[model samples]
Target: MFAVSGGGRGDGSWPGARWREAIALTLETSTIDNTDNLEPTPEPLHAGAPVRPDSPTFAELGVHPDIVRALNEVGIERTFAIQELTLPLALAGEDVIGQARTGTGKTLGFGVPLLQRLRPASADAENASRDVPQALVVVPTRELCVQVTRDLADAGRHLGARVTAIYGGRPYEPQVASLQRGVDIVVGTPGRLLDLAEQRHLVLGRINALVLDEADEMLDLGFLPDVERILRMLPEQRQTMLFSATMPGPIITLSRTFLTQPTHIRAEESDASAIHERTRQFVYRAHALDKVELLAKTLQADQRGLTMIFTRTKRTAQRVADDLADRGFAVGAVHGDLGQGAREQALRAFRSGKVDVLVATDVAARGIDVIDVTHVVNYQCPEDAKTYIHRIGRTGRAGKEGVAVTLVDWDDVPRWKLISDELDLGVDNPVETYSTSEHLFADLGIPAHANGTLPKAARTRVGLDAEHLEDDGRSGRDRRGAPSGRRERSGSSRSGSGRSGSVRSGSGGSSGRGEDSRGGPDVADPATDIAAPRANRPPRQRRRRRAGALVGEPATDERIGSAEAHQSPVPELAGQGETTRRPRRRRRNGGASASSQANQTVDTQDAAAS
Candidate 1:
């Protein structure tokens, strides 16, 4: 295997220059599998070449006839530049490091070869367990995992390759059962894949080929450790392929450590801008409050089909989606805050044309492959150049002409300028624009009379609700019914303990603090026997105290009849017709003797009693 790196070096460097340089130097000096002398290095494949009638076909590149037939059935007759360059080497079981911008057909660049290399289930030995997957693809996000699985399944349909997607957010039972039924290729996220592998539900011992798509994203999400752990679990003798839009330091280190004599193939020229040339990009400095209004107008642009609005936060994604939906635009949202089922539901709605607009965070920027996305609106400025490319790359896919609009708030102007400078966007200082701006109308082909709210006649597509949300059987709370109005007591009741005396039903009923609905104190009924009779009740007791000393004698129950009896000078006797006074102890340090004080107290009590 040989490495091919060709590109013009511009003044401005790529985002991760240090790592890129390191990779370039390593590729120059090292020989992959000591095969550098076996074959001459081929010419570099430039991405500038679009698929035309004269371009190489999948079959010419030694692709399996069954897989080629599947692609032809779907109208995919030609290979993109990345696919054209990657297919030949990958089919030979060589470790490949594919670096290409987003939306450049990287999925099939690796997927087609992966499917071709896997043995069909029907061809497996009779004694070999069909449950062991022969090929595995690890992605960063669940949406991407699903998309890859779908694409692979479509390409491998003629070959009868069972492609299953295993990821989090849904029930594990379904995935476990899918594995048990036998799978030829597995596409999943790191966490869920590791979970099943550790639990013995997923078998990786026989995996002959592995692909790590979006390796940089895995690093950004702190999933590198988990990816490493998964790598260690796999068999040492395997064909590994790592693909990413950008290569960071850790990703470079990971590639060096894990990949053996990998061919580093870059589709584009070294100095070529990562942004797609077919996508018309526009940047505007606008007020944060006016972004939604501007977005509504942008969505109303003529020929806008399946527009996407991206925000920096999940709340903003949901807010923008809600605002657009309120304006009568069919819109759905995808973000981290949403459950896996909801995310998939929104994605399905967007793909099925049920919703023409999708509001999402950066999570959707990586693996969401929609060919008909005519426009992408950055509702909030992206953090950096790499994100901006990924965000806008959703459009202008497969040589399709598209538009990208970036709305930068005042606070994000500095951040946007950094991105612009890095990507050579040239719009460091964006023109101040608003919803009613004349230039905005002309640029996006918005009708001169268009307004912020979508007219009733134009609202034809079904909304997000029209798409059915699949029951993953995990979210019981969402399927649960409203709580009953009646309240039930579970234990025995206690009286005079500051607890609720009675259990009431319905609204505006008595409260636990003994207050009625009208805020008045609740009075017990005299005719109704809510408590036991006085004759049947036990006697109440109180300890008598003289000055500071206890008398060690109990008082009668009658003494507790009224509040004033306890405050009166005469103390009630415990027995019938009996009055007793205990002798007082002497005071340690006092002006008045304890005996004198006690005697005076008894005299005052007797006088009061008389």
Candidate 2:
């Protein structure tokens, strides 16, 4: 027989019944908030209290003393505040959500604990090269992946805990081969991590602990979905630690969903005091093209040890790099288009001081953990408030104050205004100026003429004279009638033809030859006049008119005679025969004017009678 109730008195008041009821209530709350039932609240931050180490001896933390000696050999004396707080919780197998900025030494904070729980990876397991990784650390950028992987490998050198990093923009075959052998710990960006997982080259089922470094930046890059999917693929019993600069709502929600009773650790507010107080902030409004000039001047003025110039696009980053290179500066550009090998080369060059300046896009800027960057210049305004903060956060790290200069274009005023408002920077209307303005020199703390220092002899002290440049770029009179410094003449006299014809400088008859019958040189034939006027009237009406008309002669039949006949004579030729022709008297028909209509009718009647 089935018995559902635990009460002997047929009522639900028995202790056993109460126990059942309590279990049900706990399950209900667990559904609402998993943290409520699984873990205890985290410890609060103490300003002056000295934090204890996770263990008294290396053996106690499950690491050999030789490994501890290796750490000491590298000049690591004491643990950072985040390491102190997170190590104990992470080692105990409890989930942890840590809030801390970059350069706080959080890598070892989560890394050391993950290494403590790892079993000697199998020799034949996929990706298990003699000392390859079993632990996986997902970072936001390829740079961070390489950095964190290197740090972890150094920390595990004595333990022979092999580490490898997998990321995009590189060949996948090598990564696949590495996985085929085996790795003790794997650090990579979310995209490559998922790709390896999906390809069956890497497996998360055996990963005992998973660390998501720079969780905020991962979210910013729209990597949360990939992070969530990766979490689902891991064993439910695995340890999860999330580290980020800030604890926003999404971080909290993530903690609730993936982490099982995570211990929240945040450094004392004073921890951030050194960074905030030391860094100097400046904002200015200028044209987009002027940013290059301003950046040049600022770089010359500051002479900082290392500088990182951040831009919004890869094209701009390349352009800034090219401009600086042309000006004889040692510069490099990092963007998505470069192969992984090329990108690493540039980063290495910049880090080793072979390159003085690094121009990079947002993807390259975020997650960059360079230690000595003294200045960060936003060559172009960022997209949003978060990006603005992240861009400047690159410098002013590791407890040293740094300088941040932002160049805001006119079109980006509204976006910059929002970011400035949020940060309380009071730069709503940043100094409206230009690159060549005197204020630019003063603001950048440079001489007014930073253009170039030319020697006296090279200055070419000359004055302008009344010399005109001709069409051939010579300075003399243009008597050949070609285009000169004056505005090129338009609307040629040669109609419907190229400008190869000459102008009529003098008056003449048909061929500029005199004619006996028509009086002066024969009027230029209407069809033969090359420079004939282009008026709308018929050509016949435009022919030159005679000085005197024969009485009663129709004007159309007589035609117009040359006006220059009496004024000039054709030059005589020695061998030419001159023909003397008699002038013919013309029989003329007259046309009456409109005012003489009645007289015209009488004349016509008389003619008819005759």
TM-score of decoy 2: 0.61
lDDT, candidates in the order shown: 0.69, 0.59
Model 2, span 1-610: residue lDDT tens: 1123332323332222112111000000000000101112131111111223441443444545655665566445455556655676777877777777665567777878866666764544543444444577899987777767766666677777767878764557778888767677888888888988998788787777889899988987889999998888888887888888776778667866887755556642232344346567778888876777777777765446678899888667766776665454556667754334334545655655556578889886666666567888988898887677667766665446678889888898999899878877778888876767776676556556565222334222121011111121111112112222222121111221111012211111112132232223345556657686658545563322232322222223333243222122222222334522223232235754332554556678789999
Tens-digit per-residue lDDT, 421-478, candidate 1: 8877789999999988999998999998888889989988766666555444432222
Give the TM-score (vs. native) of candidate 1. Answer: 0.72
Q: Which candidate is the best by lDDT?
A: 1
Model 2 off-target regions past 4 Å? 1-64, 121-133, 247-250, 268-272, 447-449, 452-610
Estimate the lDDT of model 1: 0.69
